[model samples]
Target chain A: MQQNDYTYAVARIRFKETKLLSDADLDALLSAKDTDAVMRLLHDKGWGDGTSHTSDELFSMEEEKLWSFVSECIDDLSVLDFLRVPNDYHNLKVAIKCITRDIEPNGLFLSDSVSDAEAVYEAIKNRDYNALPEYLRDAAKEAMTTLLQTSDGQLCDIIVDKACMEHVYRLGKESENDIIRLYCELFVASADIKIAVRCAKTKKKIGFIRRAMASCDSLDIDKLSSAAAEGYDAILSYLASTDYRSAIDAINTSMSAFEKWCDDDMTAVLKPQKWEPFGIGPIVAYIIARQNEIKAVRMILAGKVSDISENTIKERLRSMYV
Target chain B: MSEILNNSGLFLALLGAAFATFMAGIGSAIGVGKAGVAAAGVLSEQPDLFGKVLIFQLLPATQGIYGLLVGFLILSNVGLLGGVEEVSLLKGSLYFAASLPIAFAGFYSAIHQSKCSVAGIGTVVKKPDQMGKALILPAMVETYAILALLISILAVNGINGIQV
Candidate 1:
């Protein structure tokens, strides 16, 4: 209410909040008998267009609907670029790789991103890096040149990924909103941890791991990059000494469990925004919650379709915001 | 200058009434506009909750009414609504001083109360059944405004009796 600028948008979002999936709702979906049962449950919740669409199609529809809904609520979409910029980096990676290999980037790019996937692909196709945003031009050019010279796809990924983290870090520092700053912080730090762990697992050199890691306020690059070079245990030790000591249990379990931990932690941090009456906090929280809902439903549907154990899917599901 | 101001009782009294009217009126207008925007948002989603959200949209309106009442009292007391009154500068200054409580309080309280009303609307949006609890929060803000209104009324009436 203090943020009069978003009073109308927050009120609309408040009404929509009633429809978000609660823990009980998620449990009901988990107990659903089969894939059709799950889909029916979703339909009952007013999800998807009324049609016989596949699970993927339904999730895609929901994503489109969420984006459209948020777009209506906000005046400027750039405030949420922290959420969408990664997709630009992802598209850049896909374009660079596919252009080098002369393959079509079908079903490999994310939509509703900062940069259009097709435009990025065309820019790479025509060797026009300047056509991209200034923030992305250097990353695109460097990534393309590296892949062209060394034919190292992973190096290109590191370049683009590092650029994405730095962009996100700058956004976090520049943002006036607390939620945006916190989200960007977590995004960059979580990504740095994941990259460090992966590079360590693959026995990449210290310098390579260091190069891939981005600087964030919460995590020390020197400690994390070096810890990663030593191996998984050193990385865990470094994390244990820092704010992420709680993640040790998840790390000890498996990579998938660590991913679930990250998401669950973020959701827990964002849960208080459910009570927030106005401001960008609740809007950002709603967007994250909707995405969480879609991911949870996708997990359940994928689990039911593949006949995976219900417990396996349950383990992967992040905590619901409501 | 002394001679001019010595006969400016009607002017001072009228200034007091205008201040109370416009200051409080402006605050209520801003508050009502804020709450109305929020209510419209809710109505867009849940048209069935029209009766409920309308209460919040109208909560700020009372301050404007209170302003009108004080303005009317001041106008009628000085005979501005009918015959001209030959009031002393001292009495008119007292009338202006007396209007100060509600003039400032009504303005501030109305805006603050509307914020609570907007937040309450959000609560009702999530839980339509808890309208009672939601209404109580904004209604509590009215206590100060009412207190200010009472003091202003008492002071205005008391000042009218002074034979200056």
Candidate 2:
């Protein structure tokens, strides 16, 4: 019923996207001598200015700073922002887990909307699920119940991830703005495809895969179900017959390659819709571009730190805008 | 005699042509405005891609060209050229018919097409190499306007109002 205010948002987004990681940034991140060297580069780029920590502290600090910067850009709450949902889900999951484990609530939880962080911590500390916010109440409870029943940490992790994916997928379909819809669909589809590949390759049972795989707007779910049941090979064949055939071979060989394939496919589909002038297309596109840049940087840095072959790392790199 | 056809009706036909062209031009202008902003944004980020994004931004202007072409075709058929100068009712109607499509179609289509280009700018932001795809979506939206132009041009050519 409401129209999107893309003009203001896209203008701001364009400026932000310009400041994102470039090819040089990726190269620098990949060649860094240590975590300190990477942190210094981030500081130069106006990221994590106040942090002088390392290990988990450094990662969490930079992550929080990034989330806060993005959260600040959002002016309207009714717009159904997709950028924040992943962090929200992650934070909620962390809170619930910390509670169940009876551990000190770490700073891994990050959110702007949730004011009562301590209440969440206390709820987790005391095993009191009733004290959390209403918005996250149902999802947290559902995930917690499942976790209690399954007791498999991986299953719990997948359930939380699926919930986040569902949030993104549903938001895409409900949105009237075509660009936003495209972005939401693309993101969900990538997540879906990645899960499908993992589920198939690991030879996980259909029940586990069913709980793990969330529906995306672009994927034909019926086709995916049949393929998933038939295992990884069947899923790859099914994908080959569709628009994402470019990803099928990669899915068969390496999980990392499959992950990169999803990213590339999303970029390919979204790149085609960039010329539209009004609504949320530009904003969504800019966000997606930024997400890809961050992922590329993280991948390159990880590859370098772990001493992976440069050729292998280069093969894993996604496309960067001019 | 043909005196009535020779004067006032010719003016009316000319007026219709101008009006159609003017309206359609407005749509193209707005679309160009939006696409120009997007192009400028992309150019600033990836200066090397100015040429590619530049072409994408210009694609939506085709709607305006369609309108202008329709207008000119109508004028030529009204014997504003080197032909007989008598304008009949049928000739006036033909000019009006020619103006109608480009007038309405160009204007409306231009707005929609420009909007698509604005969205296309985002595509440019992430992957400048895909600028062609981005522009094509809007170009698809402007296809009907091109069809309108063709219809009007053919209709205007069929009019025999003036042999001046």
Candidate 3:
């Protein structure tokens, strides 16, 4: 469809954006004395469906509400394949692990995947790889076979994770929309960087790092893999020459800090969509923003429950879109 | 050949009238439809903003009215509505030339104005108080259509004074 076709959806997104939690709202949540106080503030802000609920219940309900609202706004939800592909791959991973271990995969699947997790589990259990989507069929069969032969779960995970990243990058590249393209690029690059960092810290071999890291436009996978084989400083030095030079600090800080940087960088990239009045950019940004909000809320609730320091939780909180 | 030339003037003049009305009307329809879609989207979320969005939706509609006014003046001046049974070839050609400004300008201006209106609707959806500022951006696009209307009306009225 033409960009103008999203005129209605963009306008609605603009109005909905006003209701998104702002930085001030995050601060207010941060200042709350406990999770109960945070929940009270959330209830006042109309976060949940208005029924008395626990933090997890409220978070889950809010996530469901976001998807439902998106479904209402758009006719073809396939435009959101970039966002949904991860969940589908996650479900595939869960299904393969559960079926191999002979364990029931209850409550291990995400509800918002493009494919039903339970169906995927069933298909994997029956060894009917054809039942999976074409993009996932080969990956599922390969991962299951590798797990059955070698009994190595990490290898299976790496195979599926690489496939998922490759699929997301392909989908983004095929999309005519700039936002989706940027999102896919960032998603793959970030994942690749995360893998490089983890592998570097674990002193993994070059072959394993190369196999695990997905190719993306921004980062050089070969260089990143070699850096991972070298050491953490080499990875930092290599990142210094790329567009992600600023992220080196976050990497040096802690894994959580680096993860926070990824989320913040995405928010920074998508912040301009607020003023954009046309196309799917605003809608995509809105969905990402809501997800970020939910993530921040979950972190806060977890922190409050565990009695973590306010300053620590505050550092980890993501910046809101509104 | 002479007969064809004589009739060609009237044909051209009538074609000009049709172009003025049809092209501009299509542009306005498109413009209004685009803005209406955005307005409906906003109303679905916040129905209270209907009054503001309605004005935005109507902004591109004026180009159609301008085109119609110019078309009506040409038809009357050429005696298509009544009075004179025929026009000289020179006067007919002049009328056709007179219709060109609104015919082309109104056709493009209204379509571009609708784009502005749609963006304005987005602004109003987010910041209701910014309606005044938002309305001004789309209203700026109307200036060209008004200029075209002015030139077409003056040229049509002036054509009647020629001795040809």
Candidate 4:
């Protein structure tokens, strides 16, 4: 498709981009006295309204606003299915677990998912696999069955997570847009690396490790699984020879640090798209930036409310796209 | 046929006028349409930028007017806009040639200029303070279009003085 097709959409995205949080803004939030203080700061910056609200409420509001804005800008949002597909899988996991546990799935399911979380929950609740979207239908059945049979929540998560990663990877490969493909590549690959690191730490065998990790182009699943079997260091050594070599130090520090590096590096890599006037790239970048901004603010609020150290909070903050 | 060739001068001159009007008009339409979409996007969010984006959207429009102006010049020179007069084959050919610079330059320049205008609109969206700079970039595209207009005008007027 012609890149200019998104000219109008991208132009609106450009204006929307100005509302995203910058590094300096994040720093200011870092200095805020407490969670309420941070929310006040965000309110002042046009994050939420001036009305009294909790951070979670404000975060949900902002996510809704983002989806509304993006929906207004583009005609077809299916191009973003790769981004939302993970939410579908997460909701599926929540539903299966909640149903099996005979508990309410309140406040746990994500908003703005492809399929309605409540609908997904109901479908799973009634054991009507046909009601779910085709992409989630098979995975939902398998995960629910696995949880019922094995009574292993982790195994259920494994089944659902694996399906999620494979679906994201397949979508990325099928996409014609470079930004979508690249985002999916890093997303699945990073998940694989994290799984490898976790498996290596937990001393899980190669079979379970392979079962957990999805195949992506950037990471060699076989080599990574084999290296993961050895230990965390071996996994690190294996990554050092791959594209993720630069993240070795962050991995050495901690998985949380590695997660931060992944987010920060992706923003840094996609930052140039902010200046682009036309294409799906800028729109995707804006979405990523907004989501990251929300994540950073949530972390700050969580840390502040719990009285976590400032330096520790700063360590976890993802880089701003601005 | 010899009959058509003998009367081809008037036909050719008319064709030249049509070229200037339609070719550049098409380009301007495309340029203005593209810029207008971007401008609308900005206005939907920040309606205060209407004046600033309006200027950017109108920048590509000048080429269409220039095209119309050249078309009029060609029509008047060949007497189509006034009294019917016989124009030699050579003079008709010269008029056709003169229309080319604007016809093509206006066509391509409007498109390229609109690209610059679209980028400028994006810049203005982020930094409304840089409106002056943003306007200047696309206006530079006008220089070439003006140059083409200059040549076409001078050439058409000069062709009027020829005895052929």
Worst 10 residues of 4 chain A by lDDT: A1-10
lDDT of 2 by residue, A260-296 (tens): 7766766676674344344555555655676577667
CA error at residue B126 for candidate 4, angstroms? 2.1
Better of 2 and 3 by lDDT: 3
lDDT of 3 by residue, A1-322 (tens): 1544688888888888989999899889989998889999999998987779888778889989999989888999999989998999999999999888889887788888888888888889999989877888999999999999999999999999999999999999999998899989999998999999999889999999999988999999999999999999999999999999999999899888988998899899999999887888899999999999999999988999999998999999988888
Candidate 1 stretches greater than 4 Å from native: A1-4
Task: For model 3, name the residue pairs that clash.
Answer: none
Candidate 1 lDDT over residue span A35-92, tens digit each:
8888898999989987879998898899889989888878898888988898899988
Fill in the DockQ of model 1.
0.82
Give, for candidate 1 chain A, the lowest lDDT window spanning 10 residues: A1-10
lDDT of 4 by residue, A87-122 (tens): 999999999998999999889998778889998899
Off by over 4 Å in 3: A1-4
B147: Cα error in model 3, Å = 0.3
TM-scores for the candidates: 0.97, 0.60, 0.97, 0.96
Q: Residue A114 of candidate 1: its Cα lDDT?
A: 84
DockQ ranking from best candidate downward? 3, 1, 4, 2
CA shift of A312, model 1, Å:
2.0
Q: Retained native contacts per candidate, as fractions?
A: 0.72, 0.16, 0.84, 0.74
Q: Cα RMSD to native, each candidate? A: 1.5, 8.3, 1.4, 1.7
